[model samples]
Target: MAIDRATAALLGGALGDALGMPTQLLTPEEIDRTYGFVDRFVAPSDDHPVSRGLPAGAITDDTEQTLLLGRVLLESGAVFDHRRWVDALVSWEREVKARGSYDLLGPSTKRALDAINAGASPEDAGRGGDTNGAAMRIAPVGIVMPFEPLEALVAKVAETCSATHNTPIAIATASAVAAAVSCGVAGGNWREAVDCAEHAALRGANLGDGSARADVARLIRDARDLVRGRPEAEAIPLIVERIGTGVAAAESVPAAFAVLELAAGDPWRAAVVGANLGGDTDTIGAIAAGMAGACAGMASLPAGRIAELKGLDVEAVRLLAAELVAARFDRPDGRVAA
Candidate 1:
């Protein structure tokens, strides 16, 4: 049976994460010299900074955290549970250490969790977080919620980001990704999803610390326009240089949207191009491919590639998707089935 949008979103993020694992953190020239084109899964280079020693098709913290958030949501229902969320992060980090993976927690997440562990209030823990960590793992929030009444969705996004990324820029960027995923789960087309994302970013910017400099809505619009009719060869470099492919939420989130637009919502193509986009490649790929998969469904992904994904629980993803769909219907406004 074909998987649903929620499953596609989670799985696609993992697929993109794995696809970009080897190429992440390298310069574009380094990527070209090392892998030429990252059209298939490959083991991380021996000297890779973050993903070394991982086998081909192994996912990184991006997908692992996405699923972790999904599980938290499942256990807590639609309501936000800050304590459970923090505990899960702490436990997950311990488990990752036990496995001896260097991928550990992201900088923003680590700092916030550390503060929380030091007895800082949850509200204050993430106040300084400004990275793309929240956006990178936001797919599940989009999956479990509906896109309509976008303010509500943005509120949920804010709640999700509060534990590790409460800054305005972070919330805005994550809200954009979540809105796009929610739109896709609602069966909206790519254009509609992008539109929703922009609007959500605008709304999200109004929350959190309002003084942050970045304008995520305008950034996403510019990123999309920058690559409108350009070929992949031209657009990819343009995005890497102009919008950037860094760990900053302002950069990676917009870069992901730009890749989605450039690929015209082709999930596999989005994964491929995102993987080759250099710095923070896995995150950009995860966000872009998650959006593409949300709109196009699992059938849009290559079957062989899907089968090759390592350490991901396909059955668990499907079950979460089903439960999320049920939760959406449980909402008062839910009408059509997802």
Candidate 2:
């Protein structure tokens, strides 16, 4: 049977997260010295800051939080329930801490959740956040929403991201990723998907708190243009030096687009490149590979690796994808495409 676009997207992001797990925060040189081009899954380095002691093919907070958010989305349907979301995060964090993994929430999300715990409103809690935490785990939003008539999709992205990353840059960048995934799920080609992402970025910029330092749409365009048709030797350095692969939305999101462009929408290739990209590798891989998966579908990835995913419920992920697709088309406004 052919794999569905939604399933492909969710699995692809997880695979990318696992592939990049061992190399998440290492510099390129250190990655080369330790693991020598991490094209496959490997155990994290012993002294690794966040994911130390994890075995090969193990996922991090990226996939875990994604699945958690997905469950929340399923429960609430179209309307976002901030209370449910907060409860879910708190529970997930507690579980993660119990597991003794240092790979907890990212800075922006941690701070926002802390503020919320301290009695701040959800709307105000994330006002200062401007990182890629929103974008990294936003695939479910794209999976359950349509990209066309872009405003609706952008609105959904904003609503979901508001509690953890309410700043303009965070929302705008995440909207771009969500738009690409939605366009790709609709069977659009990579070029069309990226174009939709650009428009979504522009639309999302005005929805969140605080001003963005740079034009996210233009940055994505520039990132794509920088890597298009370039040789790997030349392109990788350019991406690392100019575009960057960091925790900031302005950096990692655009870098992910550039990596997607470089891989020509190949989910496996995109994930590999993202894993080897140095700083914030897992997030870059998750975002880029999620877009690639939506365009290419799950069959494009390795079956053995997918089967090797131990703790994660692969079946549940696929079922969630199908459910999200159903809910997407059943929206009251009839905004979804047939």
Clashing residue pairs in candidate 2 are none
TM-score on alpha carbons, each prediction: 0.96, 0.96
* lDDT of candidates 1 onward, in order: 0.86, 0.86
lDDT by residue for model 2 (88-158), tens: 98777778779997355788988887888789888898888998999999988888887766778888888
Candidate 2, 79: how far from true, in Å? 1.5
Candidate 1 deviant stretches above 4 angstroms: 1-3, 102-104, 333-338
**Overall local distance difference test of candidate 1:** 0.86
> Per the 3 Å backbone cut-off, how many clashing residue pairs does candidate 2 have?
0
Candidate 1 lDDT tens digits, 119-225: 99888898878899999999877877787877778888898889789988999999999999999998987889999999999998988864865778899999999
Candidate 1 residue pairs in clash (backbone atoms < 3 Å): none
